[model samples]
Target chain A: MSVLTLEDVNSYYGNSHILFDLDLEVEQNEVVALLGRNGAGKTTTLRTITGTVPRREGRIEFRGEDIADDSVDKISNRGVKLVPEERRIFPTLTVTENMQVARDMSSGNPRDIQEMYDVFPVLDELRENRGRNLSGGEQQMLSVARALIQDPDLLLLDEPTEGLAPVIVDDLYDVLSEVVAEDVTVVITEQNVDFALELSERAYIIEKGANAWGGTVDELNEREDLLDEYLSVGGAEAD
Target chain B: MVSLGLVFDQLITGLTIGARLFLIAVGLSLIFGVLDVLNFAHGVLYMIGAYAALWAIGAVSIPFIGLLGIGFWPGLVVAILAAGLVGVLIEAGFIRRVYDREPLDQLLLTFAFVLMLTDVVKTTFGSGSNVVDPPGLLAGSLTLTSSLSLPNYRAFVILMSIVVLAAIFVVLQTTNVGRLVRATSSDRDMAALLGVNVPRLYTVVFFVGAALAGLGGALAVPTQSITPALGNQVIINAFVIAVIGGLGSFAGAFVGAYLVGISIAVGSLIVAGAGQLIPFIAMIVVLLLKPEGLFGGAEA
Candidate 1:
């Protein structure tokens, strides 16, 4: 059975409609990349899944149970966690405190705090630092580690590599690679096509709030026409 | 020449007043820090607390604890419970509706509550002022020197405020609920996504904040008169203190309260009729120098 399935989902922000009849499915322990251009409703889809959108309709099933009308915290407690695009770390809280929050609130059996530090050794070094004091790379690591400590069944990463340097992106890729190896189900949304393709097995392309195309990573790599039509990779191709 | 003993006496008096102000202002600061709502009804909660304490003292009598006679201790407990209950209702029933509204709308709503609650107090307790005497155990003064003496009640207020401040610090720094509060105050949406029940937390915070105001009012019963307009008068000073300390900073409130208290005490001695103007002047100076207040960085 699929870990998460969204069928004909419709979402709105106030009167402005953002998603229309969006259908998606993720198998257990599968790595899926949601690819889209800016404002193509990629983030909105993640927001809808987490119940953060102001209003949403249609079926969102996790572990075969419908969660369409559940509150954000309820959905999260059921083991669906989103690492938001902005990496909303509590600036006043220390690194350990940030992880402790997720652990305290986690409904599932949480990973021990020491284990999180072991996975992200850099965080162990900066354990005493406040969230605002960390570098971009460190904050991203902490954001992911914080979610991972909750031991979420399905992890959602929204633009995790949005504002990092090449070296930092490489570091995050390694961390996420280890997380995936632990048999954790993952879904990622990214503008970095190379990074997304490298980390995901299958991919879905969304355009104008609707699914544009979906196939295996190899199939997507061969389809240059679809890439040009849906993505801004035309500029990268010229370079 | 102004004697050193006189200055010492004024300092102690200033601390007592600051202690009272801290009880009221810290609640205002906490509510704003977490809910991002300026509760104009906060003062009314304080007023309710004072009235509840007065009523409790008059109505309840226990011989065993009569050492602090006239139900002073019982009144304090009743005052806290009454104020906290009312605060919970205000947040769950009324303030929750305006969470997504504009600041002006929130202000108007709370201001409406202030008017209504004040009237309710007027009808229930009568418009005339009332007073509660200090418990017999705290009815005397402690002579420190030839010209220096501290009223036992004032000393009690000061000691109690210190204990409350310590408790607040420990809870905010060490407890799970405190960590959640800090997390929520910084980013509401993020906290929600992490499984923190934001709405329920708001109610809990409102209760704590309201209880603090009640505690402040109950403590004030021995020092000041209670009236329907008392909340309106104290709330203005509380706002000034919160602003001076920075709107969401607990440490700032602590320091700011004492600063205002000292200014009032010392200013009265140095310049006649100038004590009233000193706090405002200090506020202007602080605002001009640091618009975010003395310790404004992150919420809570």
Candidate 2:
């Protein structure tokens, strides 16, 4: 069953159009990657689903409910969690406090604090540390852990592996792969093709606010010209 | 060195005044922090609180509260609740519409509220000085040292201010709701995505800020005379304190209030107009030395 679907979504900042006729879908337990270079509407597409984009024209269905007109908080309460590109951690708050703020109390979320620590043991070490004190990798882990604490069914992560060391990326891939095991659908936007392909089963290449291609990771690996045309990355050998 | 007794006396006086300033300025800082709006009408709330207390105490009797024997404590309580209610109305009726607009727009809108409030006070109480006698327990002075005789009301105001400060600190620092507020203040959009009701939070913040202003006004009624333009005279100093401490910082407000209070208390002893000039001078110096004020970091 499709867990999330966006049909002909168009988003804009004032008069400047960012997403044009963007259509995407994710099945239950699937990992989907929205791949594009900078300013190609990948982030905007995720933001549209999260209801952060101000001017959005489209139909967004999460599970079976249409959430096109819902406010950001209402959309979030419906179990759609977005770990934004900025991460948006409260710099003044401790790591545990950050996680606590996103707890899904409405669903009586069974995910405990220790469960989150089990996923990112680094968070356990830095539990009392404030968000401002965390390193980039630690911040990313905390960001993902915070969303996980919400026990969301559909997790929208923007540029999860950006500016991270390979080892940290590997660790994150392991954590998310485990999350995917529990039937949670994840839609991630990325410029890192290797990282995206490693986690995502299906990939959609968005170019200039429209869908350029949609296929499996294997199909994307064979099309060097498609990668070069859309992502500015050379090909499979680029990784 | 100057006599230690004289310095001690001035310090006590500074603290009493600082307590009142903290009450007003902290609310200003909090409103700015969470709402990202500079409320020029905050001073007007202070003015309303003073008048409300005066009405409650039978100093100036309107139709509703003048006939009752609502003494000092009840009067102050009424003033705070009334001011907070007015704030809720203002935030819902006016400020909510301008939340996403420019700061200039918010400023002008709040400034309009200030004018309207001032006019309402003038129409109701007339343009005369209204004084509220201290409560019976706080009316007299208690002699401390040979030269240190503290007015009981002033001491009470200072002590009460400390209690309020501690309460606010505990609320913002320790509670779950406080955590939500702090998170919202850091990033409104992110807070919403975490299922925080941002609009309701904004209203609560506005109400709390207004209530603090009202409490400050009621406290000031015993120490100073209430005039329609009392808000105008005090607001500039409150802004100076908020800026000198950092616009949205709680600790900054606490320290900045004392700095401005002590400077004014000490400066007035030296020169004729130094009390007024020192606060502005301190603000300029702080701006020159630490552009973000003492406690302000990257958020400034």
Candidate 3:
């Protein structure tokens, strides 16, 4: 069953048009990767689904219910949550307090705080520390953990591995791998094509604000020409 | 050299003055901290609070309230409610329209409320200055020593400030709503995306902020001559406090209020008219030293 579907969605940031005729779908409990270079509306697509964009046209369906016009919070209440690119942690709030915000805001039954701590044990150690005091890797973990606490049916991750040391990235991969085992569906937008493909079963390539190509992970890996053309991911030989 | 007794007297006076300023300035700081709207009409809300208290005192004759031994207590409640209601209307009706617009638009919108509300107050309460007598229970002075005594009402005001400060701290520190407020203040978009109702939260904040201003005005009723221009006059001091403490830093506002209060009181002792100039001078010095304010970080 499809958990989320966007048909012919065109989004705008004030006067500048971002997403153009973007069509996408995510099946229930599936990890889908949205791949593109910078400024290709990958983040904007996630934002539009979450109703963060200023203006968006076309249909956005969550669980077969049209939610194209729902407000951002309302969309979130309906079980779609977005972990934005910048990590956007509340600097003044303690790590536990940050998680408490998500728990308090969730209309659905939120995950247990201890469960989140179990997944990201570093968060437990720094639970009393303010978000600003955390390292970059810690902030990202907190951001992702905060979304998970909401117990969202469909989670949107924007550039989850944007900037981090290789060690931190490996840790995040382990955490996400654990999350994928749960009952939630994920739609992730990424510039790191290799990392995204490793986690996602299917991939959709977006270029210049529209869908360029999409297929199973095996099919996408076979098309080196498509990766080089759209994602600027050099063919296997170039590496 | 100033005598210790004289210095003590001036410090008490300064604290009383700072207490009143905190009532007004903290609201301005909270509104800015959360809503990101510098409400110029905050003073108008304070004025409304004073006028509301004055009217409530005259209109209601609750014998039980008088029996409770605090005649003007009900008046304070009225002031907070009236000002809070007006704040809700201002936020929901006017300020909401300008949130997505530029900061100048918000400033102009609030300034327009200042003008409009001031005129409304003038028409209703008249342009004449009004004064409220301190409640009978607190009408006398408390004698400490042969050389040291304090006005009972001023002591009450200081106690009230402390109570308000404690209450706010408890609410912000312990409550879920408080956590949401801190989260929203830090990153509004993220808070909203996390399923927090941002617009409703904005309204709640404005109501609290406006209510605090009204409480300040109502509290000042027994202390100062209430005039049509009272809001305009106090708002300047409130702004100075907010700026000195840093725009959204709560601790900054508290320390800044006391500093301004002490400066004004002590400066008056040193020079005849220096009280009026000291706050500005202090602001300039603080800005020169630490541009963001004492407790102001990048987030605040």
Best by DockQ: 1
Cα-based lDDT at residue B115, candidate 1: 97
lDDT of 1 by residue, A83-132 (tens): 99999999989999999999999998999999999989999999889999
Superposition error at B240 for model 3 (Å): 1.2
lDDT of 1: 0.90
Stretches of candidate 1 exceeding 4 Å from the true structure: A234-239, B1-11, B59-70, B270-272
Candidate 2: regions farther than 4 A off: A104-110, A218-225, A235-239, B1-12, B63-69, B145-147, B298-300
TM-score on alpha carbons, each prediction? 0.94, 0.93, 0.94
Error of 3 at A82 (Å): 1.1
Colliding pairs, model 3: none
lDDT accuracy of residue A6 in candidate 3: 94
Better of 2 and 3 by lDDT: 3
Q: Which candidate is the best by TM-score?
A: 1
Sorted on TM-score, best first, the list reads 1, 3, 2
On residues B144-174, what C-alpha lDDT tens digit does candidate 2 reach at each position? 8777788889889888878887888899888
Can you list the residue pairs that collide in candidate 2?
none
In the range B17-108, model 1's lDDT, one tens digit per residue, is 78888888889888998899999999999999888888788832223432223488888998999999999999999999999999999999
DockQ each candidate and list the results. 0.78, 0.54, 0.75
Tens-place lDDT per residue, model 3, B1-300, is: 788779888888888879888888889989999999999999899999988887776732223343122347898998999999999999999999999899999999999999999988887667888777888889988889888888899899989888887888889889998889989988899998999889999999999999998998888888778887988887888889987899887777788888888888888989988987999998898799988887777444
Stretch of 10 with least lDDT, candidate 2 chain B = B61-70
